[model samples]
Target: MMVKQYLNDLVSLFFPQTCAGCDVPLAYGEQLICTACWFHLPYTYAHLDSENASARQFWGRVKLEAAASYLYFKEASRVQQIIYHFKYKSRPELGLILGERYGELLKESPPFNRADVIVPVPLHPAKLRKRGYNQSALFAEGLCRAMQIPVAALCLARVKATRSQTQVNRYARHENMLEAFEIRDPEIIGGKHVLLADDVLTTGATIEACASVLLDAGAAKVSAVTIAKAL
Candidate 1:
């Protein structure tokens, strides 16, 4: 038994599993990120501040109960590295890990703790087919695990694959995505405080497009959450 333990320790030393954010060697209980990196993660905490930029984005476009993003994403930041791994490197588990951590922080905030159900922004069928998974849904699942909330997967639908909003102005994005989303089932969300989740928030165009549909379908109110907010 001692030999087995010794061998395990020797192998761990050679591999020296490290944190994604800080590259510190992880302890036995740690996963992708180490304790230092996890605790020192750069968080946005937008949910704690009602007038944050995240909520302000939907000022006249839609009524949001609250809005927040977990992290601030810059070009070469640690948050960006983690996001890149989760979104593009086939690491679905990373999405779940991030969601759980972020969700815990969100629960301490006012509006988030009262969410009726979580709904991830739906990806277009074509995109889902190509990616083989919805990254936002993975994040939502992680959130649900942390918050003990149910996820309403069918509450929103992506009706069209609109052009990328990155190259367009806010006005152009809204115009282009005007008819991009639809609500398939109003019964699930009627009079409910819905938490709309996504992997990232850039211009908030996609969230707005989907929120408009949910509101039209009788959602009492809509709030937004994302793993990161692109700055």
Candidate 2:
């Protein structure tokens, strides 16, 4: 036990834990984030507006009740660092932390407060196996805990993995994601309001695909929430 404690102390000394966003020294018991940076994180509060910019991204293509993101992701902003840690570093708790923290504000927003279920954009099985966990699902779990809503993990399933949407143009977004997702259970989501969760909204291709599947399965309404908006 003493040897283990010494090893832990050595690791802490070498790593010298700092906030992922601001590089500030973390206090005792703090994880990869710090309290100061956490409070200063930018929030859009777009869900409260009927025609927020994030929701307007899907204007003619898809229908949604409301949508919002917790942060605005700029190229080199702290939000990018947070997302980087959550996405590529295997620190999924960052996603949940942001979701749970954002959930408080979301619960007070109109329409969002009434969502019956939370559905996370599904990752293909191969990708999920490689990543060990899905960031969107982790975010949804946190939102579910904060809102007291149930999380529908497999409501949407990816039929197959596709090439990255980044290299594709605007016109190819929909086609690139064609038949990528399908509803696993229609009965549960039929006629129910759903709050779709994802890590980021970049061109809205993946969300659109997932939303299409859910709507086809008879979901009464579909709204979206994400950690950041990449616009």
Candidate 3:
């Protein structure tokens, strides 16, 4: 064991791992993010209140039981950079790490703790193939690790490939997302309080569509969580 540790330390010295959030070289015992960047992250604390901005975004549009986001996303901010890397730069593990951290906090929150199963917003088949992974599913995987709850990735699926919601108005977003998702296996979600997770929350039309399908499939309740909120 000592020899193995010595070899690992020698390897790390030549190729030091860096923090995902800040690109700073990580010391021993540090994981994806360094201590300093983790401390400086703009945590939203939205789970503490059901009426927080994240939850309110779904009000009257979708009947969400609760909602929360782990961080606040700002243009050119570190959170944005982290998410960009997580989504487009092949750093899916960062999504998992963030999700696990968020899940640890959600475990203490009453509304989120009521979740029976976690579901990730699905990617269209073509997009999933191109990306090689679904970012939201990776995030949900981490949440499962921390929460000890099962993730039902096959329960919900995106049946249609819509244009990006970026630069779109609310009305356009709603139109583009209409009937975009479908319940692939209603049995898994039936009578369960489902926690639908995504990478971020903007106008929330995508989540609304996902929640509608889950509710129609007989899910007892649906709540949403995201890595960040772009407000």
Candidate 4:
């Protein structure tokens, strides 16, 4: 262990590790994100309350037990850069690290603490193949580590590919997401409280669709958490 640490330190000396959020050199004890950036990032304290804005967003749309996001996402901000890298730059570990940290916080919150399983919003097979990984599932894996809950990645699946939700209005987003997801094995989630996870929450059309399918497949209840929420 001592030898490995020494070699890692030597490597870092030659190629300094940089913070994912700010691109600054990380101090010795810091991991992916530096302490300053971590503290200054816009955290949404929504997990502490069941009636937060995130949960309210799903009020009339879906039967959600709870919902919350860890951070507030803004365009061209540090959170956005981190998420951009997490999804597009093959930095899946960033999702895991953020999810684990957020999961620890969620474990202290209500309905979220009662989750029996973690299920990530699935990517279409083609997209998954192209990306070489499911960013949401990586986040779920880290959440499971901290919450000590099981993850059911294959229980739900994206049945169809949809166009980018970014270029569309709310109605178009909802229409595009229709029938995009399906439950592959209802038995795994039946009678269980599922916590659906994703990288970000935007117009929330995708999450609403996933939660609807989970409920229809016999899930007792559905909650949701994301790394960030778009304003």
Candidate 5:
């Protein structure tokens, strides 16, 4: 064991892990994010407020039981940079880390504590094959780790491959996602309050699209949470 620890330490000394938020070399016992950077992250505390901006996004459009985000994302900010890494840089573990941390907080919040299961937004089969992993599913896995709840990973399906959301306005994004999602297994969501998981809350069109189908499938209610929110 001592020899193994020595070899691992030698390897880490040459290629150290760094914090995702600030790109600083992490210290012992630190994970993806360093303690200081984690403490300084722009947390939204959306879990504490029902009428928060993220929840308010679906006010007149969708009947979400609740919606919340963990961090505030702004262009060129640390949150945005980290999120870019999370989605595009093959750092899917970041999703799990953030989700687990958020789940710890969600356990204390009324709206989310009632959520019986977590259902991550799905990726179309082609995209899932290309990406090799779904960021939202990884996030849900992490949340399940911390929340001690089940993740119904195959409960929903993204049937249509819509245009890149970044290329469209909010209305167009919603239209693009309409009928794009379907419940793969209604029994998984039936009569259960679902906590919908995603990497970020942008225009919220995708969440709106996914939540509608889950509710129609007999989910008691749907609540949404994400790693960050674009304001």
Candidate 6:
């Protein structure tokens, strides 16, 4: 045990884990994010209000149980930096850590707590192969750990690999995502309240499409959650 501890200490000395939110070396007890950075995150707490912006964005497009996010993502902000590390920098654990923390908070929020299953938005097979893992699926695993909810990672799939939505107009974004997702293993989603998860909420086209598939598959209700909400 002593030798193992020494080896672990040596590794830490040479390769310290930094806080995802602040890029600072984490204190001994800190995991992914430091306490200070955690306290400062732009939390939306949208779960507290059913009509929060995250939900409102889907108002006319799809029926939902709840739609919310953990943080506000702004360009060059701490939340963005944290997400950047996971989405583009290949730090998939960032998604899991963020989802676990968010799931802890969602325990007190309705519809979210009542969700029988968590379904992460899927990536195209090509993208999944390139990225090595689905960041959303990692987030789903974390939420499953904290919320004691099962995750149906394969219930929904992205059929078409479309262009990036960053440069697309709102109408075009919806069009681009149309028919992009299909329901698989509908038995898992049928008659269950599902909490659909993703990394970010921007135009929300992705979430809308996923929810539509869930509802059509007989999901009693569907709520949307994300690590960040891009405003």
CA lDDT for candidate 5:
0.90
Please give the clash total of every predicted structure, in order: 0, 0, 0, 0, 0, 0
11-63, model 5: which lDDT tens digit per residue? Answer: 88999988877888999989888898788789999889999999999999889
Candidate 2 lDDT over 97-211, as tens digits, reads: 8888878888888788899999999899998999999999999998987888899898788887888778878668687786788888888799999999999998888888788
Ten contiguous residues with the weakest lDDT in model 2 = 170-179
Query: Candidate 1 has which clashing residue pairs, if any?
Result: none
Q: Of models 2 and 3, which has the larger lDDT?
A: 3
* Local distance difference test, each candidate: 0.85, 0.86, 0.91, 0.92, 0.90, 0.90
Angstrom error at residue 141, model 6 = 1.2
Sequence-dependent TM-score of model 3: 0.93
Could you estimate the TM-score for every candidate?
A: 0.88, 0.90, 0.93, 0.94, 0.94, 0.94
Q: Over the stretch 1-231, how does candidate 1's per-residue lDDT look in tens digits? A: 999999988999898776676667889878987777667677877878999988887899878888888888888878887887777767788888988987888777778889899999988999888887889999999999999889988778888889877898878888788688888888999999899999988888888888888888899988999988889
Off by over 4 Å in 6: 166-172
lDDT of 6 by residue, 41-121 (tens): 999989899889998999889999889999999998899889888988889888888888998989877889999999999
lDDT of 1 at 23: 64
Residue 196, model 5: lDDT of 97
Q: Give the TM-score of candidate 2.
A: 0.90
Angstrom error of the Cα, residue 105, model 1: value is 2.4
Question: Looking at candidate 2, what is the lDDT of residue 139?
Answer: 95
**Cα distance off (Å), candidate 1, residue 104:** 1.7
Candidate with the greatest lDDT versus the true structure: 4
